[model samples]
Target: MKLKNNHIATFLLSFLLTFLCAIPSIAQTPNSTYTIEQGDWLSKISKKAYDSPHLYYRIIEGTNEKATSDASFLKINSANDIRIGQKIWIPGLPSPKNLTHVPKTDCEIRLWYNYQIVAVGVINEKWMQDGIDLETRAHKAYDLRHKARVNARFMMQDKEAVKTLQARDIKKYGNPDGPTFTYLLNKSMEGGQSQEVAYQTIIDSSSKTDTRYNADCQ
Candidate 1:
């Protein structure tokens, strides 16, 4: 029996995550075939062939059963694997011989990470508002969480106090960066500091906090 590769899981996870997040627009459309090449993500290929990247998931969903069962599935940069010269079914597309059309722009971005909250800047009640799309909002949320995590790591708080905050599961209150303000407050409280001291500490380090939260949530 041949051993299965770990990269397959990674690829499936990446693909599935994106698929679950967005509603595929080309689910019922026709398909075309193409040979794989270097540095080709599904989005890039879909964009090249369909004129839109949002339709990649439809292709994946169409071919997922085959890809899932194969041992050499979804390998990164492996020429003998799922790389160059591999014939792939491009779903929700037309015949390559008849494909001479450019896909229109549909300002969107896809994210493959996690998020706890959607930003206020990206969401509104309008049917087609000017704010960022859901995909871009997801990416921005991840970026915000990552930045918060980094900030939490380098925060100039007492080590023991910070540890105490972590031990208390403060991350549940906010993104992966830890609680925007509660993490520091927890640390300060652990260190026997008053609310005034905590507020002053934040004021002193205001340059580092996220400017979006500087004005407080309305």
Candidate 2:
């Protein structure tokens, strides 16, 4: 029933309310428990904890299961739902992503959400962030895509940084198709951290289209 509380259809704006204050910092590393830090992501945590980033879903399972017993541990609805200052549990034993064992539609939604996060991660890197908000950034990203729906281009100040990442993905994944991009993203730390006030505090703005791309997700 806890999982149903997060279903998009029943989603409420109240979830957007700010937490009064950040909880006191929790222990890091000694035992698998971690306080989500800026730039911290499940995959990155997995890499440090399990030696493989691909096993991030294990954290999702571990954290969510922990939620059932401890209200302090919030359930991570999706890969992109983690917020700064929250507590996360890194499972000591291997286990599948329990959350992913859902209907086919949910699986696809998860994939789409993951893509949005990756796109946001790319933009947030060394691009233009002169104190602009997420909504504005989302709009700008949408504008770039709209301007050139095919082969859109917005030069970054640090071309080499993005270029380096791009080059690495090209060599590791070959070309840049959906499957290949997904594979590369899963191994990245770009979308692992958040600079916002709360988790998913605003509109989803990392897609090639509008930030709220409900195209196939709905």
Candidate 3:
């Protein structure tokens, strides 16, 4: 009798452990679909589902496979090309709590924001030179620009500080040569005043020698 009781207890414990281990996988099943709506770009959808807009590539890869094939589908060429009313498959994503948000100062935020704008402008000019359609180029530009802004926002924890900097940028620059935030931040960082001043100074000095920014790629 004693031996039988011991055997039963061991069996129950093993079953309990196995069930507990299976819970997480069951919870993470990704057999879900999302219908695209107005202003619903792949990056935005990825951000909402996975906490980072950069992860849209995962959705494209997962859904483009034969497993999720359906008649009513929109081909996803780039993150910028999803149309309204299209249905997309949602892949299993890790928990949002696992993601990291890097903190940045107001000055750093402005600099990064401007850098992205200029980078997007450069890409846009290239696309024009390549003779890509206006609509496709516009979509790609919007996606790239939006991703840059979203990334800058993610790096900073202070929302109020960002707002203040944006307002200051608009009031001061009011349509400057580069993006408003970039120009203002560059000016602020000039003369080695801030920590980033050294890096910005190097970039500024090199601009005189490098014609990449001035090249008439278009």
Candidate number achieving the greatest lDDT relative to the actual structure: 3
Global Cα RMSD, each model: 20.9, 19.4, 19.2
TM-score leader:
2
Residue-wise C-alpha lDDT for candidate 3, range 113-214, written one tens digit per residue: 544554554465577799986546544654555566557766778877557656765576663122433453466566557735533332222211112211
Tell me how far the alpha carbon of residue 199 in candidate 2 is from the true structure, in angstroms, after superposition: 26
lDDT of each: 0.43, 0.51, 0.54
For candidate 2, the per-residue lDDT at 152 reads 20
What TM-scores do the predictions have?
0.26, 0.32, 0.30
Candidate 3, residue 69: the lDDT equals: 64
At residue 158, what lDDT does model 3 achieve?
A: 84
List, residue by residue over 1-218, the lDDT tens digit for candidate 2.
77887685345544443332444444344247888888888768777786655456557767787888999999988777899988888766312353354323433434433443434544554344567665465445544433332222122234464466456655866643112323323433256645342122222323323213322332
Clashes of each: 3, 0, 0
The 10-residue segment of model 3 with minimum total lDDT is 209-218
